[model samples]
Target: MILEFRTYRLKPGTSEDFLRVMAEDSVPLLEKAGLRVVDFGRSLVAEDGHEEAYLIRAFSSLEEHERQEREFYGSEAWLAGPREAIVSRIESYHTIAIETSEEAVEALGRR
Candidate 1:
């Protein structure tokens, strides 16, 4: 299995706004595109003098993750939704794909 770990650094004073939009707008759109959003929350550990939020998504493969994300980004739903606003709040974003054991996957509630 593969996990797509995404971290976002928000602009100063924008963390709360970002999280609100993430839950109400982004997560639902991602789910509609078949992305299995496993978890998302503010980071307990600070980094780079920015407020950080992370999202973990389980996927069958990195290829699938890329395909789904590409489609999602191009969709009319995304264009019409909060994409622009959400991105404007982010100072930086990063993503990494990791291979994981079945046990680890299940432990992440990805069954």
Candidate 2:
């Protein structure tokens, strides 16, 4: 599987609003497009009080990931609804070919 990790640096005091919109709207929309949201998180200690949040999306392969992105941006949800609400200013960082050792995967499974 391949994972896409997105980190959001949110305007201070808007973490709750961001989380609510994500849970109520964004997640469902992505799921509909076949992208699984593996995890979501927020920073506890903000740099100079600016909030940060992260989202991890999982796909079976790179091709699947690309296909999902196309569908997501082309969908009604992207054009007219939930996606419009949750996003403020977004800065995207990219990572490729993450390697997880077997021991780490086993340890995570135990959790």
Q: TM-score each candidate.
A: 0.90, 0.76
Steric clash pairs (candidate 2) = none
Q: Per-residue lDDT of 36-63 in model 2, one digit per residue for the tens?
A: 7766767676766667777776666778
> Candidate 1: which stretches are off by over 4 Å?
109-111
RMSD of each: 2.0, 3.6
Leading candidate by TM-score: 1
Score residue 45 of candidate 1 by CA lDDT.
Answer: 79
Worst 10 residues of 2 by lDDT: 102-111
Model 1, position 102: C-alpha lDDT score: 60
Report residue 14 deviation for candidate 1 (angstroms): 0.3
Q: What TM-score does candidate 2 get on C-alpha atoms?
A: 0.76
